[model samples]
Target: MVFEAILYIAVLLISAKLLGELLYRINQPRIIGNVLAGIIVGPALFFLVQPIDAIELFISIGVFFLFFLIGLEEIDLPGLVRVMRGRIFAGSLAGFFIPFFAASFFGLSLDMNFIQAFAIGSVIGASSLGVAAKVLTDLGKLRSTIGLEIFTVTAIIEFIAIILTSVLIQINTSDAPNVSEFLWLFAKMGIFFAVAGLLAVFALPKVFRIIHSHLRAQQVYFGLVIGVILLVAYFAEISGIHGAIGALLLGIAVSRMNREEYLEISKNVNAVGYGIFIPMFFAGIGLHFTTKFVEIDLWIIAGFIGIIVGVKFIGSYIAVKIAKMRPATTVAYGVMSKGAVDLALMLSLLQVNMLDDSLFSLLVLGTLITMIISSVELQRKLKKIVQVKVGSVEIGMLPIFFRRTVSDKRAQDAMSIDFQKTKPNVSVKNFLNSDIDPKEETMVIDDDGRLIGIVSKKELNNVHKKSRDVALISDIMEKKFHTVIPQDYIFSVIQKMNSHHFEMIPVIEPGFSGKIVGIVSSKTLLNLLAETKPPNPSTKS
Candidate 1:
């Protein structure tokens, strides 16, 4: 059995990798292939793999780690606040409640008990962050209005999943429920949040700073944090919640630390996650579909698949439209993709017999189908988004895109250089002394007789003693290069200057195969601006 499990995991990953490569070629997400890999290796065709308790637990561990990473990435307090707003909350409520009620009605009509119906609803209502993240990323719309709407609504629904799970536990555990006994689970949940919240506000920031500052070595820090994550997870299980909840809370607390430090660590964590646990988790879900379950009744299977697959389309479409997503359809499609987490939820239900094998395999199939559609639609819509300016101001907080343009006057006057007009074959190094005549300026040239970099008399004296000889014009000459089309503007140059705090910048000639045809300076820009503007009415006193 153990050997089968290992073989099971190995074959599943290899399949995922091959499909992922194929998807990458078509400009589709690797994750799309991964989910489909699960379905194919699973019940859809191959009976090669089987769902076992151990396989399910590994998948669950993957889910916790995935969410822990998500929580760390989601440090936007203001964004979370926006998601928690009333409209989103309302949409999430409708999504969970309506689908749940619908699933329960079908279950009851089909002659299953209330508990079974609830389990069906739980399976249907869950969304996959891994699938959703990939879909949004592939669409290149993760920050789009629709993406936000999907994320917000889906995030809220996760809370509902937890609540629903708790309710099932209560129903299953209690023989004759008393109010006091019921209160225990809810009380435990409240305690979990209260403690997690307190740690977030106080203890965690200092703890994270200590780890980030002192733990300079990467593996030691990585091991320690993973240990903490698992420890929290184990305790969360002991504390009457899913282990994932503990990992999530741990992430939330850690994410609240100093952003720079947190971002650096997040970069490392993401690398490890994408490289290892994430793909393993996604592929492992496929191993659970044993194919024998497909012999179950067709309608019973479709009903299970329909509730899970169908609700995502309807719920995501309606919620996103109401949430004011610009192109509601595209957003809805992106949100429809299912992921490793959804499969994990299904397997969790299966592991505990909250869902039967047939239903689990069917829902997994739905996730698989929708993921294909999600990839196509997401990629199409993402190509339409132009880099638009939000307001009248040309300046973005940080220059995400640079349309390089420098005006000729500001470009020429700054460096005041005319390479063709100047004396040729003169090496600028002969005049590196600041004590030389101010009127005499040094021009630099590379071995190809093309200008590479320039050094001013003032700049030459400051060159370090060790860098004295080999620091040719190529070495000390302003290594940074900027370009100008004969018709560019001053404001653009200023923007670059603002970025690099450059007093002077080299300018390459338009359509010329030469090193910097000229240069530009801040003073030249100000002078040009002064020349263009109308003269001051009141002159000197």
Candidate 2:
């Protein structure tokens, strides 16, 4: 049994890697390849691999880590909470109910019971937080305004769907409508959050910081993090919420640590997640696909898909339009992406004799098709978004799509070639005595003119005069600094400067050889933005 499980995992991993790479080379979402690998290898086609308890367990673990990583890297929890009340909340309310009621109404038209119809509605109503997060992360826009809005809205929609589904399940199984069950579950969710808040505010920071300061073994730290994630996840399950939420909450809490600490931990976590667990999760969705499509009524499935897709798109479009968000179509397609949650719900209903095999197959097939379509459309839409100014102050907060415009100026156009330069071996005394601007950074370069470090006049002044003659420029220069390529957008340069608190950055030649060509200062970039003349997009400095 163990050997067979290992063999199946090996095959899936190898297949996923090959297809994932192929998709990446063509600039498509690699997750599409990951899912395809699953379909090709699983019972849907080859019948060589089937979902077993062992595989299911691994996939479950994968899911926990997948959401956890997303929460850690992609989301800014405090920021998300702050923006939840405005257009984001409004969009979520509309997005959740439009498809939900539409699906339920369709189910009722088919003469299904209220409970079953409502259950189906819950499945359709929910947006996949996983899908939205993955696509945004792939496009490097998860931190953008649109990305934040998507995360906030998708999370709210899914949270409400889970609660509604849980309540409906209780009511369906009982002889009477169980108000007490609903109250209990709601109370549990509230308590779970209250406890999680206390942990985030009071417990996790101290614990992780102590471990980071006192511990030496990387394995121990990784093990402890995984342990914390599982413990919280277990609590979440007992509290009548999905374990993924707990993992996400923990991830958000852990992300509050100092950036250096966060990055150190994130590096290891991402390696394990992207390397194994995340791909496994996507393939596991594929594994659920069974070649059961022939028995379902094609027209019925088509109608259902059309209704859900149309309603979802219109609903999201209206909400975003009212909110005055740009690229409303892209946001609509993003919310349209489906995931394996509905399939799981359908399978559960099928097992309980609430739904027939044909209906189950119909829903699953419809979901898979929507998943692929949304991913393709979202990627295509993202590539075509033009960068236009929002406002002077708010421009920096714009989505990455703002940088994709052909008219945007590149780093080479803004950079100055006349800035001060110094050799790494030059004495600090000699460097300071030379004709250097105190306000500007002196770039330290090697013999090959490659940027190695930077020495600021302010930094040298802080050192005692007695040590200035003894110290070399290399000793005082900051070795770790950011650089921009000649072709990078000026907005990108501003972002890096804002992030790192740098006044100036070196412009280096692209590729392996980082030859220092010029420099861009915050003052110069600001002056350019203040110019009256429209920038010539074709010009390079």
Candidate 3:
């Protein structure tokens, strides 16, 4: 059994990675490949693999980590609340209600019971936080105002969906559904939120601080995070909510910590998640595909997909339009990108026998198709406004430019040949006394002449003032600063600089041993932009 399990996992990982890479090469979402790999390996093809118990457990863990990471990446509760006002509520309501009711009506017309119809409607109503987040990140809009609004709306919708799912599950299992039972379920949800909120606001920060202070090993920290995540998930389940909700809450709590600490923890978590668990989760979704179910009505399935896609888009568009929000098109795309939670809800309904194999298969197929279409459409629309290319590497979507200039060229072309460089061992006092500008950034090099770190004048001044003993440049330098290579497009560098609020960026040679070549400043880029003229789009290099 152990060896078979290992072999199965090996096949899953290899196929998923290969297909994911292929999809990415073709500019399609890699998730499509992951899902396709599962379908091919499972019932859709040879049926070589079964959804074993052990594999299901791994998939559940993968989903937990997936939602956890998304929460950490996007949610800042205080900030979200501050920014989410009337427009967010308006858009969320429209996005949730239109498709939900429309799908419910369709389900009833198909002769499903009220409970089953409501379940189907709820599945269609919920947005996939993970899918929308991936699209926003790909377009480099994850931190923008519109991105936040979308995230805020999705988060709210997800919370409501979880509550609704829980209630539906209760109704399905009971022989007689009573008002008291409904009230009690809602009460448990309220208690869950209250307790989770209190713990997040008070206990979590102290626990993290202690963990950081006492544990230096990355593995140890990773284990602690996983432990907490699981514990929270347990609490959520006991509180009559889904485990994924617990994971998301814990993630949001952790995101509110100190930036550096959060980044360190999030980076390690991401490595673990994307490296193994998350891929398995998506593949597991594919494994659920089976044609052994009851006859699938192609027309009904078509109606399902059309309603989900069309209603979501129109609902979001009309809502945002009424709210007087700009960029209605972007918001519409975001609302249209649905997958993760919808799949989860459908699975839940299937487990309870609320949905038969045919309906379950229809929901899964329709959801996947909608996700792919929405992602492709969003990418196609964004490409027209801004396109960023660095050599053969594309850096998401950037703002459109009307003209081309020297500054619009590669970073290697416009970088200053002369820039300040110093050995890592040089004393801070001596470096401050040198000819380097106190207001600018200075690069630190090692004995072998490789770029090691960077130091700003403010950092040096702080070290000089705070420390009684002398310190080397290495002591005050920032070892984690962003670095650009000569081959990198200037637009890519500008995006980084603008995002980080950096006045200057160091340019290094490409390869493992990144040797400092030159530095580019905003001023230099501006001068180049002023000196150069626009080129014909068709004739320009």
TM-scores for candidates 1 onward, in order: 0.64, 0.66, 0.68
Please give me the total number of clashing residue pairs in predicted model 1: 0
Tell me, by lDDT, which candidate is best: 3
Q: What overall lDDT goes with each candidate model?
A: 0.62, 0.71, 0.72
Off by over 4 Å in 1: 1-9, 27-29, 35-57, 74-78, 82-85, 166-178, 384-541
The clash count for each model shown is 0, 0, 0
Q: Write the per-residue lDDT of candidate 1 for residues 387-492, one digit (tens) a residue.
A: 2221111111112112222223344544546422122233334435324455433433443544555455446557765665545444455544444533456556
In order of TM-score, best first, we have 3, 2, 1
Top of the candidates by TM-score: 3
lDDT of 2 by residue, 327-348 (tens): 5677777766666445444544
Poorly placed runs, candidate 3 (over 4 Å): 79-85, 144-149, 292-294, 386-541
Write down the TM-score for model 3: 0.68
Q: What is the C-alpha RMSD of each candidate to the true structure, in Å?
A: 16.0, 12.8, 13.2
**lDDT of model 3 at position 48:** 70
User: Worst lDDT window (10 residues) for model 1?
Assistant: 390-399
**Of the pair 1 and 2, which is ahead by lDDT?**
2
